[model samples]
Target: MKRISVLAAMACLAACDKSGFNYDNIIDDGGSLQYSLLDSLQVQMRTVQLDSIRTSGTGTGLVGSYADPLFGKFTSSSSFRLGLPSETDPGLKAIYDSVELVLQPDGHYYGDTLPLQRFQVYQLSRPLVLPKDYDAFYSHQQFPVNDQPLADVTQRIRPTSGNKVHLRMNQQFGLELFEKIRSKSDDIKNEEYWRDYFKGLTIRGVDNSAAFRLLMNDTAVVMRIHYHIVKETVEEKTIDFHMNLSELQFNSYSYDRSGTPIAGLTPGADGIMGETTGNRTFIQPLTGAVTRIDFPSIAALKELGRYGRIMQAELVIKPDNGTIKNYPVPPRLTLTLADKKNVVTQGDTISNAAGVQYGNLVTDKLYPENNQYSWDLTEYCRAMMAADEYNYRGLLLAAPFSEFHTQLNRLVVGDGGSKQYRAQLKIYYLLYE
Candidate 1:
């Protein structure tokens, strides 16, 4: 046994002295131990289209449209119901001045905002309602609106300036609303009556506009009806109608991929392979698109030795150069386990011993080659190897749930076989002889 141990140690040192091998620590417990590094494992990647994502009650509303050469066209619209003011009566003698819709930016946006963007507000034909079977609205849900717009405004949006956008509504619509409040009519007296009369409003952007998010808090978005009384030198008063049920507010997202690489991609389907699309995979959370990674040859690692353990595993994801120039990638990404059907396994998020892992991202603007996101997959590999059967399971790379439903962040990464930037998985295994 002593002579065998010495010979094994010599062989381990000889292997480590190779050009691409580094000497890692060793473990000796009456067994011959050797460390080997493998980075040539097969990694398969594809773009998966999620069925639908909940978009209601996210505390943020999206609006506007933008076209991308790689991602095609994306459009978002916000819809919400309005509530009557607490002070139901504006007084019988009050005269109507004007009404305007105020939208407060939450400092989140995608695409360009330098040029003027056009926004239109239309009253929903029916009230916003969630079906009995559904708990919340999804990004694909949309309600019908009137033919004519209640408000149309075009202006340059300043997302970072901490300013409010005041869109003056149609004169007739404002006048009718003001008249009902002044008279204390039933339509303006209670929530039910008000919601029926004024179902809600959907704010949308015209074509070729940049997408932006608006604050959906209690005081961020509202419609102020200006009025005044003829007594005591014309005292001015404003009655604000805020969003009635903020929980019901939702943003509807639509996309057009007719001329894009993923035009034929179908939701809940087998997904498009990376090699078929120029060795690239896509992830755009707003549209429920995620990147799927599979390791078909992972089992081959077990053939290296009779008894082995994975000491460390690392996954590095590299986005294609020049894809993030104007369109920024998601700030953080999560990896979740999904079956072959692309259904995510609940509570199966990938993590290390510490906690859930968000890829520790490193950006390199000057040296774009260094831009990458990496994660420790030591435990995940161990579990995958210990499974009873080859479950046809894979990892779905996506943005966090909070940002996934509310933001338009996206990323495009290269597969393992890419020429410029490729996703890589490196594993350090300890072999016992």
Candidate 2:
């Protein structure tokens, strides 16, 4: 009896639908007025092409969920091929220099109806010195002791039997070395001679007198300065894959010191390196569109010098009024560094092996609520360090199914004609001596 009643009810409903509504009319309207699938319902949509974008800050912004602070979280698929004379063959180097993603609109535009709504830039100020090792910074600066044995009075010039001489910066600059040195002084620029002499000797000094020094292998120092291309600003022949969106527009944004409008920069395959060590936190002051507060993770804070805590982030956006008709937001993409340990030690030659460990990262403002990272970062860092392989995977950072660099590739999807959003991507940098 229940089954018969249920069948009768279904029939009645079906009959009522046919009698009261016309499915044909709805289709004619080009909208699902009466009924349709999700895809068919959005007909008034304006399309921004899949080919229009490439890049986000997180290596995973291409597929992850993030509201990019900078429009950098998004960029057009513009191709750039730079000319580098230093490279002999330029195979990998050539490829690195020839990749970029161009952003395209459904229609070409000009003048009052510019296809792109917002174009901005950001400038970050960083300190010149780097902090790579522990005990690197001090209240009073000091130099390293020379690692090589001193000149050999006996075959090998070993400094004074057991006493190894530590060369400080002041020692070479002192009156003793500068006043008495007689070699190569005739008709030579005295300043040039002095500078060369200091470079040759591992002179040591202690602080005003404060010029400190540490004696290290010149070969090691030279090795540290090597410049291998890390990230190339690029536009590739093809993209990995892409998604389609009806429309996108920019609303309000956190404006910091986005540098001069990004227009000043030529988009090309320029291998840029990470400006600082990976994931250090600092407070960045803002002017125009850049906004915020910052407190970087302990590991990142330590890795980046104090200046890094206050850093600049660029959000490249083409802002539009709330309801612009067809402006498109470029898709955010990312290139993640394969994480490993102890592989990269030089500015040049960024190997996939040298990417920083995922476990070592800690961002204070990764989430939108603007929550703070642990204040006692040393303790928090220690706790993170204590995790074993078994428990650490998901607890510290999110776990991945197959790929290791989920952080780099994650990006936010736009919806409800949302105006403000972001996708982030990273570039590595090097300081060559």
lDDT of 2: 0.20
Q: Can you write out model 2's per-residue Cα lDDT over 1-433, one digit (the tens) per residue?
A: 1112223333433443332333223233443222111111110111111111111111111100111232222221110111111212223332221111112221221112212122211111221122476322221222332354222111111222332322112222222322232222321234344223322211111111011111122111110001123355443321111111111111111112133122122212221111221111111111011111111221222322211111121212111222222322212211112112211122111112332122222223355322111111222223223444332211111112222211122211222122332112111111010
lDDT of 1 by residue, 378-406 (tens): 87776666454545457889887667888
Error of 2 at 240 (Å): 19
Global fold similarity of model 2 (TM-score): 0.15
Which RMSD values do the candidates have, in order? 5.4, 27.2
TM agreement with the true structure for every prediction: 0.89, 0.15
Quantify how close model 2 is to the true structure by its C-alpha RMSD in Å.
Answer: 27.2
Q: Cα deviation in Å at residue 251, candidate 1?
A: 0.9
lDDT of each: 0.81, 0.20
Score residue 350 of candidate 2 by CA lDDT: 17
